[model samples]
Target chain A: MLIKSLAAEWLKMRKSYIWSILAALPAVSILIGTANYYANKSVLTNGWYSLWTQVSLFYGEFFLPVLIAICCAYLCRLEHFNKNWYQVMTAPVSRSAIFISKLAIAGIMMLIVQAFFLLLYFCAGKVLGLASPFPIETVGWMSRGLYASIAISAVQLALSIRIRSFAVPIGISICAAFIGLGMYVMKLGMFYPYSLLTIGIGALSQESLTIAENGLFLAMNSLFIVIVSAIAIRYLSKRDVVA
Target chain B: MNAIVSTHNLSKRYGDAYRVNEVNLEVHEGEVYGFLGPNGAGKSTTLKMLLGLVKPSSGKVVVFGKEFDKNRLSILRQTGSLIESPSYYGHLTGLENMRIMQRLHDVPDKNVCEALKIVRLENHKDKKAGLYSLGMKQRLGIAMALIAFPKLLILDEPTNGLDPAGIGEIRELIKSLPQRYGITVLLSSHLLSEIEQIATSVGIISDGKLLFQGSMEALQSKSQPRIAIKTVDNETAHVLLYRQGFHSVIEDDALIVKEMNDEQTAFANRMLVQAGIDVIRIEERRKSLERIFLELTGKEKSL
Candidate 1:
């Protein structure tokens, strides 16, 4: 059922500008990220780690959350346009199937954006002519960033589904990003859903993650995914598609 | 015939007022059940309840002999609906939108083109839905609902934006639905004559209540003939008609007397003249469906 819904979801996004936006945000992050890395390269030792230190922080903290939110908001924009929820709801699928299919599609879109970011980050490092051995830890940082992105995507999906206004979800995401940054500064980033990205990406950490920190990150992410996905699915199923 | 949709005491309340209050409705298989009501008269609410778009406040909705609460997906599998206004993807082209619906319904691609041809939108298939005129948009909506060729089709004022010829085509299409594809239709309309044209059974609702539900013959017999008289002296005619023990009410520029036949019309004319009141005209008129609709809804004064 979700596969069929995804097929349908892909058709809706064919001509939409969401593709450009998805590609553009990562480009912005890459541009800003490599620029800052090069400006401070004299004080840095490890080239790839130095590159990630700048790039992933900007992507994980700001661009990633808002991009996830916008992807969700645009994915649901069809439903908001011309009252398409009433049409989709009457299409013989269980309400849960409808909600989950949307989440799954949003997750796929999030992956696309994350992948684009990883590609751009690597390309920028190559362009900077960095000669240090490839920092395999960069893969862990990007994967964790993707994992934490799904958690944030769950909550953003819930918000976009409940609120018909598109701007509200994006606005809420902007505020939450700054708050997540605050939590990151306070050293309690591992506990908050918003700060999961900062902790996972090791943005504020002096060194790469320890085994203990990694376990905690994985545990917190799984718990958040289970609890938040359950809540979002329940809320969406119970909602009345009055439009 | 077995009922495809049966509602018992179905109601939806907002605040203290019932949007649909204790309405019991039955739509039998292979019949076009026309739900007739004026605006804000619970037509949309009742249809919404059946579609599960709006939850019923109380009562049961049984589709295909199973409760909607238990068999929602099953019920919806065989049913398609259009509520109030048509819904479409303005960004996608007409054909692309149809493809989306086809995928969502998990049906074959063949139905998409066939449905577009039925609505006569095959030529405009590549055009963006936002550019389609209101009538074209309405046809696209109908095409989407009919694309799956479901056994039951529920439409709320489906003829909204169409020319007279387009309406005629749609009426003919609806009439052929029962036998051509064995589709049972439950459509709501505020236009009495529209229902009179294609309905097999009619349900009249007003202020969230079902005022009448029966065959077309039953509705016609329920409303008897009346005399509509225009006179130079309406007040004098009323006084004279009252003296003769006849009931009459003064509408704008006309004196309407109920239950009047040819004999009563001649008698009223003779008596009005005998009482020195000039009778300008006395026309014997039959009760039209519109008149009966207004009478049933008690909105006679509402122009």
Candidate 2:
């Protein structure tokens, strides 16, 4: 059932702007980051780390949350816009399967987006002639970023599913991303799911997280996904889709 | 004919008002059950409960002789429905939309093609659903519902947005369904005429309650024909007709003598004239489905 649900979701999305979004956002970040790297090439000592610093800042601060929000919103848009909720809910499949299948697909799509961003980052570094060895640390940071995105996807998915309007969820994403930024500035990013992205990526600020802080980061991401996913499932279970 | 669907004292309330009262419904196999009501008469709500789109506030639904609440998925697997409006992915083509439903039902590609052909949408199967007109979309919705070869079909106002010719085509198709596929259908509509020609059984509802539920013949039998007599001496004709063991009233400029046939029509005309009250006109008028539907719902003022 999950496989069927996933297949249908993928087919529906493929016919829409999903691919363009996955490719476009990361490509934009890379191009902008490459331009920034060239402008400050004279003062930079370490090439890969400097490049990571410039690009990931934009990726973490602005693009990442919005990307997750748009994907999540777009994921629910077909059912919402087409008013197919009642049709879908009346199907033989369980709502839990439907909700989780969407969640699983969102996680997978975001993972692919993350992989694309990483590849773009590497290619952009080579294009800048930053021939230094790959800073394997950035891979660690992006893996952490993936965990944080799961957390955002869970809650954002819940919001997208609960609300029918397209722009509302994306609007919430923009405003919440700024709050995440504020929390990060206060060194309180560990408590907020949206803030976990920048903190996890080791972008925005250079201070290294203590091992204890790192454990907290992993725990928070796991906790948010579990709790928010539970809430989303509960919402779906109780939802009386009138469409 | 075994009962394929039965609801027991089902009801749905919002706040203090009843959207659907404690009404029981029975639909038999090999039946095209026409669910009829006027607008805002809880026709849609009743169908929604049967489809499991909205949970009932009280009572339960039984489909295929089992508890529907416990066997929801299995029951749904055998049931296909279109509630209120057509649902489609505008980005998908007509064939693609049918294909998606086939995937959900785990059916073959041939099912999609055949279902489209049934609705005559196979010609435009490649067109995007967004561009399809309302009638086309409605046909496509029926195609999707029919794709799985479901044992039972629940169509809510399926003929809502169709031309007269399209409506007649759909009527013929529905009339052929029980014999062609042996599919039992529960279809709801506010327009009595829409269902009158196709429904084997009719369930009439109004104001959150079931007013009448029986075979179409049984319902039509409820409409009593009367003798329509108009005379120059109206009051004298009234008194003279009453003297002959007939009760008559004036309706639409004619004297309406209830429950009378051809013999009585002639008898009343003779009686009125013999009493020096000349009869101007006398005719037997049988009530139409429209009249019975209006009277059944207590909205007789409506056509």
Candidate 3:
């Protein structure tokens, strides 16, 4: 039943314009980051790591959270469009399957976007004639970034599922992203969903996390995902959803 | 016949007021049950509760002899429904939409094509559902509901967006489903005439309450025929009939006798004529089904 539910969700994702979003955000961020790196080549001597700070700054702080929100909202937009919730809720499937399947799809989308952003980063470095070898720590950044993204997707998916308006959830994500910036400045990044993205991507600081810090980061993200998903599934099961 | 679906005191409340107040619906196997009501009569809420789309505030739903709360998925597996408006992905083609339902229900791929053909949407199957006309969208919704070959079909205003010809076609299709495939249907409509043409049994709701529930013949039987007698003097004729143990009332300048048969009409006319009263007119008027529906719905003032 979960497989079938996943397939149903995947079927709706077909022919949608979501790919354009996945491609545009990272591409535009690379453009701005490369320009900033070239303009600051006088004093910056950290090579690829320096470029990472510049590129991930806009992508992680603002664009990435907004991207997750848009993707989650778009995933639910079809169901909220014309009473499609009635059809899906009445289907012979568990509510957990439906909620989990959407979260999975959002995770997959974020994975693709993360990989694309890394590819663009590498290409930008190569194009700049940077002689330093690619930083191995960047791969760790990408994986952690994807994990944090899935956590954010889970929360956004819950909001999108409850609210019918497409723009409202996305707007809330924007506001939350700003608050996350404040939390990151206070060294409370691991406690908030949006700030986790900033810290995971090393958007402002490219330094590596200690072994204990890495463990806490992963644990915190998992905790948020589980709690948010549980609340969403419970609400879906108990509430009445009209067409 | 066994009841394919039944609700025991099902109710839904919003805040302090009830949207559906203790609606007990019984839909039997091999019969088309029409849920008749005026607008905002809680028809949709009651239907949603039956399908588990809406949670009942204080009651339970039983389908196929199993409680809905305990066996929702299993019960829903055998029931197909199109509630309120048609639901579809505007981006996908009609065929694609049907295929999704087919996969969810775990039916064969061929069932998709067959269901489309049943709704006469086979030719337009490749068109995006959003671009289809309102009637076509409605047909596609019905096709998707039928794709799984569910034993119990619940349709709320299935013919809502169709033209006259399209409405007639769907009406015929729904009427044939029971005999053709043994699918019992629970259909809802605000039009009494629509229910009259399609339903074998009926349940009428008003103000969130089930006003009446019985066979079509039973509802029709409520429309008793009365004898209206017009004489040279209606006042005297009314008194004379009252004295003869005939309960009558004067209305519209005629003496109205309630629930009179052919023999009673003949006897009353003969008695009036021999009493030196000129029997100008003796007409039998059967109350219309529409009037009875209005009265049950508490909208008789509009008539």
Best by DockQ: 3
Which residue pairs of candidate 1 clash? none
* Weakest lDDT window of 10 consecutive positions for candidate 1 chain A: A234-243
Better of 1 and 3 by DockQ: 3
Clashing pairs in 2: none
Q: Interface Cα RMSD for candidate 3?
A: 0.6
Residue A205 lDDT (model 3): 89
Please report how far candidate 3 places residue A189 from its true position, in Å: 1.0
The digit string of per-residue lDDT tens for model 3 on B13-99 reads 999999999988899999999999999999999999988888899989999989999999999899899999899999999988987
lDDT for predicted candidate 1 compared with the true structure: 0.85
Superposed model 3: Cα runs more than 4 Å off? none
Candidate 3 C-alpha lDDT tens digits along A116-144: 99999999999999999999888899899
Candidate 3 lDDT at A206 equals 84
Candidate 1 stretches with Cα past 4 Å from truth are B226-283
Query: In model 1, how large is the Cα lDDT of residue A200?
Result: 78
Q: What order do candidates take by lDDT, descending?
A: 3, 2, 1
Candidate 3 docks with a DockQ of 0.85
Question: In terms of DockQ, which candidate is stronger, 1 or 2?
Answer: 1
lDDT of 2 by residue, B203-242 (tens): 9999999999999999989777777889897877777888
TM-score of 3: 0.97
lDDT of candidate 1 over A33-141, digit per residue (tens): 8889888889876778778878877887888888989988887778887879889888877666776777777777777887787788778988998887677776777
lDDT of 2: 0.87
